[model samples]
Target: MKRGLMIASALALCTAGCGGGASGTAAAAPVPAPTPAPAPSPSPTPTPTPIASYTPAAAAIPTAGIALPLGKCVNMGNHLEAPNEGDWGRAIAEDDFTIIKAAGFTSIRLPVRFSGHAAMAAPFTIDAAFMTRVRHVVDLATAAGLNVIIDMHNYDELMAAPDANAVRFAGLWKQIAATFAAAPATVWFELINEPNTNLTNAKLPAIIAPALAEIRATNPTRPVIIGGEGWSGIGSLATLPMPADPNVVPTFHYYDPFAFTHQGATWVTPTPPLGRVFGGAADIAEIDRNLQTVRDYIARTGRVPFVGEYGANDVAGVPVSERINYYGTITAAYASVGVQSCAWAYTNTFRLRDGDHWIPGMLAAIHTTTTLR
Candidate 1:
């Protein structure tokens, strides 16, 4: 589920033409065949050139790493990332953090649209008022004893024209990193929501590398989350270049079998068909196959994998029971492979709430083995 309206349009052009020449009136003179040229001798194989191996940069804060207990998180979605709080049907009230903390959630993933509040020119400055509002939310969540992930989200302009905005993107992070430099380690920074458009897998590392360096300069020990292209899809994880900093956590968003998870979502183009059900034997197998790849990556590199976002859209037509089953299967699959996950949202779009109360089934599915400390 994306933060704002998505417009997808494709244009294609096709043309065909054929020409025929009239038959020649008289017989044409025959041209003599030229003598064949001798074949060239076979070329010898060139010696193979050895390529230099890539080594990740050593961690500035060697002792900083992801601790397993940071489990069962939820996105405070449809809130700060909007053009304004409450404009998107949800607002970050101080008590919302309390409700989340009381519901057994150990972490909160706060998505902020810094780009909307930033200047379009060089040294792109984030609005002071907006930064203050973000700081207030961070204060509220952190005070509630929840680990917080302040993510850069819904920066469509930047994603569309990354090169033009690379300096501004890094500029925003430098200010943010400095602002939160003194905050506790529980507060984590996510470089960007999902690198796409001009920022393909090959191009993403170049953009992120500078922003990361800026963050390290200010807060060297803080844990930072980074995801791959294709909207950070789990399958794209393998293509993500590992950051030199060891404290970085490679994140992926899972909405496997998109037809099932995003069914009836109005925001999606040609909206996926409705009535798709989940949790069959085949569904479980597919889930396992997807998660196994992440597990394998974790085994190869000691870094733990984080499912930064995962949830099914809550369409009115989809059966509540089916939604619960989908959530349960995904949560269980993550647990089976020791991957940390955060549900897509707390109270918007794919919400777990009705008014101020949580839907018991939805909460139960996400809090599967997690106990509130």
Candidate 2:
């Protein structure tokens, strides 16, 4: 979703790679669909609603649907990498965390770009003291009864480069994983943020293993999320080298027809082509394509697909109706398929368009309990 010029929606901004600060990732090309098939929705309703502030013991592989207890997870947004939280990228305002939990989101995806800190080494290992700051915020979120997905935000900048950079990136994960080995189940590891196609499954574990192994060594049962190549785009999901452990889930970002969704993005080639408002048929169309990938993946590998990131930015006078429809379509799509999703973010960038305690109606896609059950 990188745009050449910022669109003037009521919302603010985002965080993708590094100082390279390109438009956030466009979904990498999806692997070819096997045979177009009808889309599927899981249609699950918990016998008892997942309790708020409930913590479950960490499991190696999570149960595949909404029944497992993960309500809805949104991003902590700017506090980690946006200009507002620049130093060490470790700060989190208590108010921000409260806003998220209050909004009905049960989890927070904390993406941090540690490389910005001068203290980082070549492979971009996060500094120790900075990690303490990270742990502190994590404590705040978990204490608030929210699940946390600690992402290694952006490391491929060094990874795509040669020598010490790759080593540093690999080592950075090891350091992080080792540090949080004892973290609660609510705090899961989302290995390296989004990777490019160049990182084939064959080569993935090599870079991922060192870090994953570090975590497994300490907490073998904790679920760890891993994304596919093609900048970890949904299309690239089919090629994922999902970890052997059942607790592992294959993850990818969903931004279809990037040309449309990322209309003005400069980092992307051919920029975004068609211009479509958020929601309805486009939502259905988007979900259709998504479930095709999910069913296709399930048919082929029996593994489930989850959206690590998916949402529309409030740019270019994008209507609240459009946002609401878009999110509604998304919620229905995921609910029907039984896909467990973590929507885009909740912050200054691509945020929920807060109107005091109320998030904008357009962003309030979750109009029903079914959306998160």
Local distance difference test values of all predictions, in order: 0.66, 0.55
All-Cα superposition RMSD per candidate? 18.9, 10.7
Model 2, span 142-190: residue lDDT tens: 8878888888765545445424455666566666777777778878877
Per TM-score, the best of the predicted structures is: 1
**Candidate with maximal lDDT:** 1
Off by over 4 Å in 2: 1-69, 82-91, 118-125, 162-166, 264-275, 278-283, 355-357, 367-373
Quote model 2's TM-score.
Answer: 0.74
Q: How do the residues 319-349 of candidate 1 rate in per-residue lDDT, one tens digit apiece?
A: 6776777677677666656666788778865
